[model samples]
Target: MAPTRAVAATQMIEVDRLDRLLGAIYDGPTESPPWNTALQQMREALSAAHVTLMLRPPSSESHGVMINTGQVTSQGVESYETHFFALDPFVRLPEGEVVTAEELIGSQQWLKSAMYQEYLKPLDIRHLLGADIYTKEGIECRLRITRSDDAEAFSAEDKALVKLLLPHLKRSIRLHAKLDYLECDRQLFAGAVNRMLVGMVTFAQDGSILELNQEAQRILAEKDGIVRSGTGIALSSNHENRDLQRMIRQALTGGPVEEPVEGPSVVEAMSVTRPSGRAKLGIVVRTIPLGEFTGAKQRPAAAVFLRDPESSGTQPSQEVVRRLFGLTRMEAALALLLAEGLTLDEAAEKLNVRRNTARTHLRSIFCKTGVTRQTMLVRMLLNSVISLG
Candidate 1:
């Protein structure tokens, strides 16, 4: 084949591999292929013995995901991470640019370096093609493909292949980071909701249940007046059931007319009667506006907050209270006592502190929480989701 035709054929093959790698990277949040597997495939395509992706490169503390087809051992990788990374010359290369080891430090200089003598020589690593593909917020992601002592040096074609892959690798890393952040946020939100004393349930526009917090699950498990039926919840009383369904419809449809012409009258508080002469459950249904950024039609339209007045309130974690209010341990304890409906003097006695000291702590708590009165402070603390934990 002519040189141009050969180059075209090689380019076509690399493109096919790139497409496969891109597909794997984009496969849903939970389903992306492992970095090592993708790197290994690229290793084979580039005819290199080793491929490594270093995150936050040049920092000795930074780590790397490496795939080696040669004699690189786990201990060698550990040594590289623990020590040799500080001496890695390619890490300091210009961001978003691709270069070879020889280009960065000529063969003579690389061979003379202590890094090569003490580390690379032992692993039989000789040639390397690398690129700093991504850089942001002091973090740099570098890709390196290495050849062994007996293997041929990286040619222009090999460099071209890596250059072609740089942008995709950058994009895939960013996508993975974003998905990780979203997952973390979701877990935090779910955890906070699950720990709440108030039972909470979110519903779609059609009144189908979207999600229920742990408290809601517990309430439904009791099988009192309210129960879940298929995807939707049900109330025992025909009148109450109809009322709930109507309220849900109103909330979904942006509230009722003649009730309030103000902003949105999408809030309704009702008492749900239970069987066996049990106390009625208090329920507040409120519309959950689908924000502009959330354009999905299937998003939740309303949230129902259920409160069983007979049930004891869950104690707010002291550590959480301190963190939220920027209070000391003593102040947090005082706040919790007040939240439990204790008067300032009663709380002071309970905490074994002098009334004057308790008064001082209360003032500090007021300043930190931005609430002036004891009633307002108690109300704010009770309504906060932190108490759920």
Candidate 2:
């Protein structure tokens, strides 16, 4: 037998090999990836009979993810997890225990599983070796490595190799967990951008559309709103509000840009052309270099800021009110402020109106709704779920 010192050195060497294989973490994983490269690299490095990447949030069911698998059938990776793995016995093991393939084969749990015998037997998979790890978010993760029946169950050497390799697996898994989370957040943010009440159209500095939120698109479609494409936005259809166009132009020049119309301002209007147009078009704009939010700088072309009439420094728009009240757009918007516990003055601040003006709108609201008081209106509107806001 080798001396204890020699054994320790050999183990150290093996661990180092695994560490080198794992190597450095590159800059954050890109949201989009070419799937084939990830799969091939991991498969070659692990030398495993089978490997799976998994992520499970706390209080939710777990999933197995393989990059190549995620690409071919975006839905396949998650299917077995939802349907099959809930009953997987091996998953219950503590973190870091390497259950050898034979051990898994010999388990009472394995023999007892009708799914395993009838299903896995035909596939020639007779043994499984697995490693479980945890993330900062407290999800339990495990990779199930398998071997065919013709091959002897993974030997002690296999367990040692796996043990040597586990840390790399853990680091990679953690990175994947973070990448998945960031992706979820990115999708959620994009959803928010697409749903905002204002008619927003953002682009790269080069002037390509990154996103035009739903409300913006509707306004653009309706001709109720004006938006410029690759060239520029229209000032106005009537006298042509040159000042507003100038603001957009200034923002395009890569500086801060804003045009404010005084509902009742202390200062008089100042413009190159003193044109009197009722309901002036006011635009707040900014320039976005390529890849402002996205990693690659070439993704976006500029950000065109728009605040249309329904969003005219007012309380939440009809769309927001609709979502909050679960009511039709017009009715929800009509009742929104009162239903949300905002008194006339608070509503005025949100709507950028005087208290008296807000009171006038409230009277109109009462006439339309048949409700005399705010408290009564709120109670009636929020009976089932008060927290929708």
Steric overlap count per candidate: 0, 12
User: Across residues 344-379, which tens digit of lDDT does each residue of candidate 1 receive?
Assistant: 999999999899999999999999999999999999
Q: How high a TM-score does candidate 2 get?
A: 0.54
Q: List the candidate 1 regions with Cα displacement exceeding 4 Å.
A: 1-16, 27-40, 47-50, 58-77, 121-124, 135-139, 148-150, 175-228, 235-302, 307-314, 317-335, 342-389
Candidate 2 lDDT trough over 10 residues, lowest sum: 265-274
TM-score for candidate 1, please give it.
Answer: 0.68
* Model 2 stretches astray by more than 4 angstroms: 1-37, 44-49, 57-87, 104-115, 152-169, 176-196, 205-209, 219-228, 231-281, 287-302, 310-389
- Candidate 2 Cα RMSD (Å): 10.1
Question: What tens-digit string does per-residue lDDT give for candidate 2 at 140-223?
Answer: 666556666776666565566556556666776567667789989977776654444445666545444567766566655544
TM-score (all chains, Cα) for each model: 0.68, 0.54
Clash tally for model 2:
12
User: Which candidate leads the pack in lDDT?
Assistant: 1
The C-alpha local distance difference test score for the whole of candidate 2 amounts to 0.53
- 169, model 1: CA deviation in Å? 2.7
CA lDDT of every candidate: 0.78, 0.53
